[model samples]
Target: MVASIALPRLMRIGAGASRLLPEILGQLGLSRPFVVTDPYLVSSGRTDTLLERLASAGARGTIFSETVPDPTVASVEAALAALKAGDFDCVVGFGGGSPMDTAKAVAVLARHGGHMRDYKAPRLQDEPGLPIVAIPTTAGTGSEATRFTIVTDETSDEKMLCIGLAYLPVAALVDYELTLTKPKRLSADTGIDALTHAIEAYVSRKSNLFSDGLALQAMRLIAPNLRRVWTDPSDRAAREAMMLGATQAGIAFSNASVALVHGMSRPIGAHFHVAHGLSNAMLLPVVTAFSAPAAVARYAACARAM
Candidate 1:
């Protein structure tokens, strides 16, 4: 059997990875960027700091900070309109999953000119869109490394899972420093999310040798440190491990795909307005208990890895 894999073209990981955005952009030949983020990041001045750094590097950037959690089709449309309003060369996704998802959707819609639902699951958007550079503030979603994005349909109240290479970022800046300030609840939720991703990818029917390696490594990194980071948000070592684990888990699932936990968690998030990671965390234990019987060796491998 053959295994296929895809990942960000460029990745900068570590303490100051986010600070290398300008250089990363320059490497990609992108100067004018449409920066997409959430209001919290903007209000916290992280957005301003990034913009200032971009300016210092002679890269002009425009900011759109209206992205909401569990990004909506309407929000994506608004972001696309903003992207179209400027002469930007690429899209920069700054912050967590929502902003990244918004950027991915806008990038594709800017080139394809269609509704968010048009790119939903089972639709393979192989053609690249505007280049995306993701800077993830949270360690959980791994939106920075994955070739997938999720947006919600307001009209139907359904969470739209958009997949394909087009959604993958051209570059990802994985800086654990950014996650140091994240609250305990968020840390716990996102950690569980990454763990679930690793486990599901390992057990998935689509799992391959390449993805299996990543999944196991992700489990080894995430499981032991998840609690350490949650117990002490300022634990740099734990935070760093969690960040790397999340990205690896994302890469694993992106290549092999997620299984029952994710499939069941999405709707729960859409209907009850639960956080994506939190929903996944809630479903993981039950899903695993039921699934382990069928895949004893795989589950055992996961247990040993964790």
Candidate 2:
């Protein structure tokens, strides 16, 4: 069978790629942008720094910083309200997974005129939404690279997993410098999450040659560096490796797919309000152990790759 791979049209990856956000939007002819982010980034002043850089380029953006840890339909609607209130030309996702996912949702819902539930899998939304520029502040989740997003339904208490090229960012600006300030626990949890994405992508039934190469490379970059970043947050090299590994793992899984751990972990996150990466970390070992028997050789290959 032939495999289809989808990714952002433009990707800028390095220590300070985020500084190019204004240029990216200018190149895309998107003058008016609305930013979707979480309160933490706003409180920490990272959001302000980014806005300041954009202003220097003669671009000012409307900010919606109320995104929650587990983004909800309510939160998405709130963002949509912001999107509708302004004549924004594009959406900027400028924080971790939550803000990125929220931005993706707002981009789609604002155009299609529907609720988040209308686009949940197995709904394939290859049609485009508003142009989105994703700048991930965290090293994990890889939301900037992937063609997927997750938002929860408050009424039903379910994590609605949305898939398709529409959810993918039009452009991704991945800068490891944004992750230097991440706390130790967040560093550890998100590192494990990226590792799990690599392993599952390599082992999934949907795996193919291109995804295999990416997954293995992601594991190679993540395994040794994950611990280093957690122990010494100031280690620039380790942080860069982890950030690149996370993006690779995201590309791997976006082209392939995640297996049991992600499937099981989503429900846990929906019920308990756990962080997406932390929930993945909680279930990675147990789910891998249970599924290993069915694909021993594949699992062994992952072990050797790591």
Candidate 3:
């Protein structure tokens, strides 16, 4: 079957890829940018690391560090307020999924002038927003590479899954070095989330040759390295593999889509405030067991790939 594949316009991937953000922005012709990130990254000094790199190239930007774990409508609005307060040329989502998703929402809301709920599924937001350059600190979420973003509606307590090409980041800088310091639990959960993405992408109703190839490769990279990184956080090789696996899985799922596990996990995440990757890990085994019968060959392919 013919497949429709979507990806970041510019993907700079390597150990210290984020250091090239300035060059990437230059390529996109975007100068002044507002960085969207969470306070934890700021407290941990990771955000400063990115800023320093950008500053080395004489490109400094404002930061909006109010993004929360599970981004809510209120958080998006807060980011929009920060965005509007600046004369920025672009948005830089400079952390994990929450910040990236928040940046995507903020970019859209700031440009389109409406609530995030208006851009949720059933309403495809294909109209462009401010250009976004995603720099993911975690190996999971792959929000850096995807054309989808999730935001929770505080009043309804529902995680709104916003989809469309408009949400895709214009560029992605994937630096595995950023995840080298991740703790055991975060490494394990995000690794499992990446694994689930590969498996689900390979077996989804939307799967195609392009996605299948990426999914299998992602599984191959992730299966062996997941435990390695968890047990030995200082293992650079394992960490790099996990990082690439996550991005590959993100790309695979972005094009082919996720199925039962993701659908079930989102609601759980909204209600319990569990991290998105952890919630996906929680539902993976159970959901996979239930969905395998209908897609036995595909499931087996994933197993063999792993």
Q: How many backbone collisions does model 2 have? A: 0
Best by lDDT: 1
Pairs with steric clashes in candidate 3:
none
TM-score of each: 0.98, 0.97, 0.97
Candidate 1: where are CA atoms >4 Å away?
A: none
> Which numbered prediction scores highest in TM-score against the true structure?
1
lDDT per residue as tens, model 1, 1-306: 888889999999999999999999999888999999999898889989999999999999999999999999889999998899889999999988899999999999999887888888899997999999999988788889888999999888899898889999999999999999999998988888999999999999999999999999999999999999988999999999999999999999999989999999999999999988889988888998999999999999999998
- Candidate 3 regions with alpha-carbon error over 4 angstroms: none
lDDT of 1: 0.93
Ranking by TM-score: 1, 2, 3
Ranking by lDDT: 1, 2, 3
Error of 2 at 217 (Å): 0.7
Question: Model 2, 145-195: lDDT tens per residue?
Answer: 999999999898899999888889999999999999999999988888899
lDDT of 3: 0.89
Tell me the lDDT of model 2 at 259. Answer: 94
